[model samples]
Target: MHRGFFGLLALGLTFAVPAAAADNLKITGDETVVTIETDDGVVDITRQKTEAALIGGVLQPMVPVPGVTPVGELEVLDALKTKSAKVVDMRTLEWRTKSTIPGSIHIPYTEVAMRLNELGCSGSQGAWDCANADKMIAFCNGPACPQSPTAIKAMAREGYPPEKIFYYRGGMQDWVVLGLTVAEDMF
Candidate 1:
């Protein structure tokens, strides 16, 4: 019974020690050092030290694409008000059915490739038409989502000029968060 109790204690200590140590390791370290212990050997990650940059003297990690134009909710609302731009909702049909921006066109990302011609652009004439009067802006769920980018890329590949394509990366989440009006009826 003494030997069994000691074995159980050892087992508990083996598991608890690592977890307790891991909790103490700060993720904000200049060198994100990681130590891994395996049955084979102990692996030290000291060489993986990364220099962290300070934003205003505090650590601020860089985003994948910095300075991305965040189409603000106010901009979208203004677009709707002024009727200066065509807002296309790239949300899925189910999402569109639930709610969307008023005066926005519904075009699901899945169907964008097939319905490229319906965008009413003259760029299909075999040259990029950045000057086309029918400019289009795409929006999806939000900045973290990629559906709007996919739709924009599809439009560009289908002869729509890149200049005419605007991405509203802030998307529906920002619109709703800003308390902007939403149309429950599909357009």
Candidate 2:
């Protein structure tokens, strides 16, 4: 009788130990580590969630564009050929180094404010030579990326006409997906 009781207790502990360890792995708002038992093998899941942006007392991810329609790849390419538009590649340094659209200018989001003058827009004269010379389209990584919108806002604040600014939300990812040619050298 005593031996049978001990054997049952040992069997219960074998299953309970793994359950407790699985529960211990979870950490909220930081990194969640979970052990999943599968038919084939055990799998571990670790995910780190990003913080949300606050807007009007509601938390949300930063949107790339508010209410503007993103121009198509063909449209942008045609504009480039006609000299009717210019593209400002707002991708990060690491991303830009990998690949970029041909003839696109490099203006990382963080540097847009300081480099506004380089766009050939004369702040002193209150004229946007680059933007006015042709439509100005800004792009970064992709639709989920927030850099391009920030760049557009910076340009607008610097007196680049809003009407002339077109946000290319599709960005470099879309450009490459469409099999567009990427320039190895920076413009």
Candidate 3:
């Protein structure tokens, strides 16, 4: 009985060990690959590959969204420090309450088009200062999410200048990932 139990334990470890190791995904070039090692051999599993045409035999970042500037954590931090940007949170009320980038105002994506003035743009042109730059920026969950991008488009439809609008593509995901401060109560 003891010999059979030990044999089964060993068999289980063989399968479990490789699975745990393979959970470490590798990103090489534009593809996501999972490499697993077992007694028999190594197995390569390709989960996804980004589709992009090689330009001059070299890879480049994916095509950017038209009329949107992607801002990183550093840029957002700078903008907050200077008070240069009117940061808007495109997340829903639930997500905002849980955690959000500090200093971003709560503006659900659905209301952005009509609430341009409320967000900071003053006039019918969505103008704060005609002579100066636009400071309105919006963000939501992250890259895989569309809330922020949708809000930006809504602003554009409301006659907001594309150049004035900014998109914090990383949003809450990147903010927390970088250990940035999150505001729970205030917007």
Question: TM-score per candidate, in order?
Answer: 0.57, 0.58, 0.61
Against the unseen true structure, what C-alpha lDDT does each candidate score? 0.61, 0.63, 0.64
Task: Please provide, for model 3 over 1-187, each residue's C-alpha lDDT reduced to its tens digit, 9 standing for 90 to 100.
Answer: 4646347656774332334433432343444455688665676654321232111111212213466676788888888889888788987787788878777778898877656777556665444422343676777776555677767766766666777777777777667777788888554
Task: Give the distance in Å from residue 79's predicted Cα in candidate 1 to where it truly belongs.
Answer: 1.9
Clashes of each: 0, 0, 0
Please give the ranking of all candidate structures by TM-score, highest first, separated by commas.
3, 2, 1
Residue 8 CA displacement from its true place in model 3, Å: 32
* Cα lDDT, model 2, residue 113: 68
Looking at model 1, which ten-residue stretch has the lowest summed lDDT?
53-62
Pairs clashing in candidate 3? none
Q: Which candidate is the best by lDDT?
A: 3
Clash total of candidate 1: 0
Better of 1 and 3 by TM-score: 3
Candidate 1 lDDT over residue span 1-187, tens digit each: 4656347556674332333333232334343446788554675543211222111111112221232234566677777788777788987887787778889988898777666555665444334443453666778776545677766766666666666566776677667777778889584
User: After TM-score superposition, what is the CA distance of residue 23 in candidate 2 from its true location, in Å?
Assistant: 18
Q: 1 or 2: which has the higher TM-score? A: 2
